[model samples]
Target: MDEHQGTAMKKKSSHASAITMNKDLEHWVSSEEQADISKVIQERLKDKKPKGKCDICRVHPAKSICIKCGNSVCSSCYFTMVGLCQNCLSKDTIEKWKNKKTDWKKILEVDWVD
Candidate 1:
């Protein structure tokens, strides 16, 4: 009857509705239907192949692809450490060194100014 009691009843109803909705969803699909859907998905995935030419050699068929950049690369150009094609991984390394060089230059400039 009071505002507090009304709010509590609304909260209880919402919670009960959520549980009922979840229960309804649990039986929405039969086990056979689920199995069929999963089988179809697996078959489709199995047919999928990595796309693009080798990023490094640019000639060989790419056997592996980088998960991050999705760059197709041959086994020879694939770097396992970073899970990237050699070209991408080397660019990352070079960028890091460039940043470090700029940082060192800035530090030296500050020291000289002082």
Candidate 2:
């Protein structure tokens, strides 16, 4: 009935509303519809291709695209650790041939040509 009591009631109502909202979010995220939506998103992303030639060499067809700079690069020009093209990686690294230091030839079973 007092001003203090009204403020306390408002706080309690806000807390209750927050709890209800969290429950709704949990239900929405865990539902079958959410799974279907995720699947659809992944499928759409898989079909998407990068635009233009390789940003690094600008010669080869871009097979891998950088998620950060959105630069399209060929497999030979792409650096997996930094997720960037050869030119971008060179700028970030202290050494230009830092990628060559790693024994990728021995590690990977597949043959990768430059």
Candidate 3:
């Protein structure tokens, strides 16, 4: 056969193979009764403490405090130091404080709430 005809046949074979693979996957899941298995898996995977208190808010466990501004922040908020709710602090300043190379007494003092 010509190169063009060979390519067309190869393409058709690939498409048929893909359809067959998908059908096999669907049948495998159906035979195992995936929905019930998944439900049991989910129940087993359920966390003991499914929902915990907010880390930032004093109403909950405080995760970490910002170096520039002494505001309590959660694990998510700790990485970024910029945003509306963000307490923006330069990374350099935090490093200096951490190393005890600078006196950040003023910044370190927590005064987030009355």
Winner by lDDT: 2
TM-score of the candidate numbered 3?
0.29
- Cα lDDT of model 3 by residue, 1-114, tens digit: 999999999999999999999888785567458678667645644432213443445355546544444455566556553321244755676566457753355677754453
TM-score of each: 0.33, 0.38, 0.29
lDDT value for model 2: 0.72
Give a tens-digit lDDT track for model 2, residues 1-114: 999999999999999999999888786455788688658655655655766777778888888766556677888788776666666664646355654577676789767788
Candidate 3, after superposition: displacement of residue 88 in Å?
31
The true-structure Cα RMSD of candidate 2 reads 9.7
Candidate 1 minimal-lDDT segment of 10 residues = 105-114
Off by over 4 Å in 3: 22-28, 31-36, 39-48, 53-114
If ranked by lDDT, best first, what sequence of candidates would result? 2, 1, 3
TM-score of 1: 0.33
Candidate 2 residue 35 Cα shift, in angstroms, is: 18
Candidate 3, backbone clash total: 0
RMSD of each: 14.5, 9.7, 17.4
